[model samples]
Target: MNDTTATLDAPTADDALTRPFPGASPYDTYVHASLLNSLQQPLTEAPDEMGFLVTTQVMELWFTLIVHEWRTARVAFAKDDLDAALDALTRSRRALTALSGAWAPIAALTPARFNGFRAAFGRASGFQSAMYRHMEFLLGDKNAALLHGHSGDRAVHEALGETYREPSLYDEVLAFLHRQGRPVPAHVLDRDVTLPYRADPGVVETWRQIYTGPQHHPHLTLGELLTDIAELVTRWRSEHVMVVRRAMGAKPGSAGSSGLAWLQRRAARPVFPELWEVRGAC
Candidate 1:
């Protein structure tokens, strides 16, 4: 090649990708990596504390993403946009999978290792996580008391209260199904959105129909996607319980919860209960 052609083809030190910016890198600006990295201020020198703190923070980000996707799916369902709804649910399933995997770092902390830093951050339990509560509310586990727990923070309380008042993701799914000629109960369709969702026999039968119908049906695909999401959430909670058991062994949680026992009970409650219930009928 000629010298000019060679110069055009060759790499240069001034390439935009290699050029330094005057301030923070473009990636850091977009992702706020500096802010995120700066937030992990471990209260103690204990090595395990850093991993614990980071893992918890990582889960929070995942919770935020999952909640966002669930809300998107809820709106799409309301508009009878099945493709968009399914896409959002699929994204949320991936997020939930990552959230479940986040336990790895602190998953095996011995009681002694955990104790080394546990007391340093007293009364800051995982139970106090507002984002996690948002995820629960989106899953139809509305609890007014839990929403009230963040009353001290007006912004957080208001945001959570709105989610608390709105129809849950599953509620929208049922409404969509009803619009599509499924026999979702009138009472279920008209129930107070603020209240916790109870598994209705009618709803179970609706899902049962979907489950027992043609295997390639779009509605059946939706049911299976929801089931996958539920199973991932259950697995995440179960893993959390096991991690707490291994790390602290039935000790009280940092946020005044019963810790392992509380988590175990919470894990037992299935997400999208009707979807799971229909499986047995099928």
Candidate 2:
């Protein structure tokens, strides 16, 4: 190549070597990596604390992404936009997997290691995570009681209340299905959106039809996408239980819910209930 060709190629070749931005690079401007890097202020000198704090924060970020994507999916389904809904669900599945993988750093912390730093950060726990609650609400696990817990913080409470009153991503899916000629019942479609979603046989039958149909069908693809999401979320809960067990045994959570036992029960509850129930019939 000649010098002109070489100069044109220089930009591509020197991508790794280039640091000559006029100010911050577009990436830094959009992603704010410098600010993110400065966030890990571990409260104690304990070696394990930083890892624990970062892991929790990483999981919270993943929760935020998943919630955002699920809301995207919900709105898409509301409009009968299957492609958009699937795209969002696909993004959310990746986020959930990342969220589950985040447990690795603190996965092996023994009770003594956890105790070394746990007390320093008083009155905080995963139980108090607003982002995680948003994820749960997106999955149709609407708990008015949990939403009420955020009342003291008006901004958090109002944000959470919006999700609480809005139809869940799953609810929108059923509505989309109904529009597509599926037999989602009148009561289910018209039910109070603020109420916690209950598993209905009608919803289960709708999934059964999709699952029993052509494996490559679009609706079936949606079913599988939802199943993948459900399984990943359940895996995260299971990991949380294991981590909490290893870190604190049966001790109450810092936010006060009988830690291991409470998480165990919460983990036992299934997500996308009809998707799983349909499997037995299919």
Candidate 3:
């Protein structure tokens, strides 16, 4: 073929796929990848510090996602939409699993490696993560003292204060069940939302009925799904403790908290109390 004919006939199929954007790639623009990359300014020269910072930041993102899903689930339950709530809970469960797996990179850090950069981040601790606190609040682990701790940041404190006053994911779940004619106690439904949730015998009995009833019931399905979320949350906390123990071996945590011991205590607390109690009776 002549040069003109050959050139015209040449494949143009891949041009659109390979075309460059006017400024930034669509993916970068949408995900703010440039901004995210700019955030990992590690303060140490330690080889492991970068990985540690990245892993911790990634976990924070996962925490944000889990909190978002939980809030969605809570709203769904409040609206009496069980299917939507379950879907959101399932998403959070997957996020929790991924969050636990995030420990893999730093899980085996030697004391020397950890010490290489630990002091670089003075007074900064994972315990002070506002997003993580949001996750805890959603799980009915409300602590007014913890809420007050963030008061120095007015915006964060106000936002957390709202979560403190609002019904938690578990609270909405129980209210949904009560609306469906389950025998959840009036006192539980009336309890102040600001306080940390405590297990009630009436709630245990309510769960017991659901557990013993028809296996295919929707309430039973909800119980199992909630149990799954709780297990995943506990698994993530336990993994955190394991990672800390390996890295520092009971050294004091940043921000003045007891490191391993504090994490151990947190990991020991049950996520949904009545759900577990109902199992023994079943």
lDDT of each: 0.93, 0.89, 0.93
Tell me the TM-score of each prediction against the true structure. 0.95, 0.92, 0.96
Candidate 2 structure quality by residue, lDDT tens digits, 1-282: 899989886667557666688888788899999888899998888999999888988887888888899999999998889999999999988888888899999999999999999998898877888988988887888899999988999999999999988999988999999999999999999999888788899899988988888889999999888889889989889998998888889998887778889999999888888898998998
State which candidate, 1 or 2, has the greater lDDT: 1
Put down candidate 1 lDDT per residue, 1-282, tens digits, no spaces: 899999899888679887779999989999999999999999998999999999999999999999999999999999999999999999999999999999999998999899999899888888889999999999999999999899999999999999999999999999999999999999999999999999999999998888888999999999999999999999999998999999888877788788889999999998999887887898
lDDT of 3 by residue, 1-282 (tens): 899999998879887788888999999999999999999998979999999999999999999999999999999999999999999998988898899999999999999999999999999999899999999999999998898899999999999888888999999999999999999999999998878899999999999999999999999989999999999999999999989998899888888899999999999999989999998988
Give candidate 2's TM-score: 0.92
In model 2, which residue pairs have backbone atoms overlapping below 3 Å?
none
Clashes of each: 1, 0, 0
| Top candidate by TM-score | 3
The alpha-carbon deviation from the true structure for residue 47 of candidate 3, after best TM-score superposition, in angstroms, is 0.4
Question: Poorest 10 consecutive residues of model 3 by lDDT?
Answer: 9-18
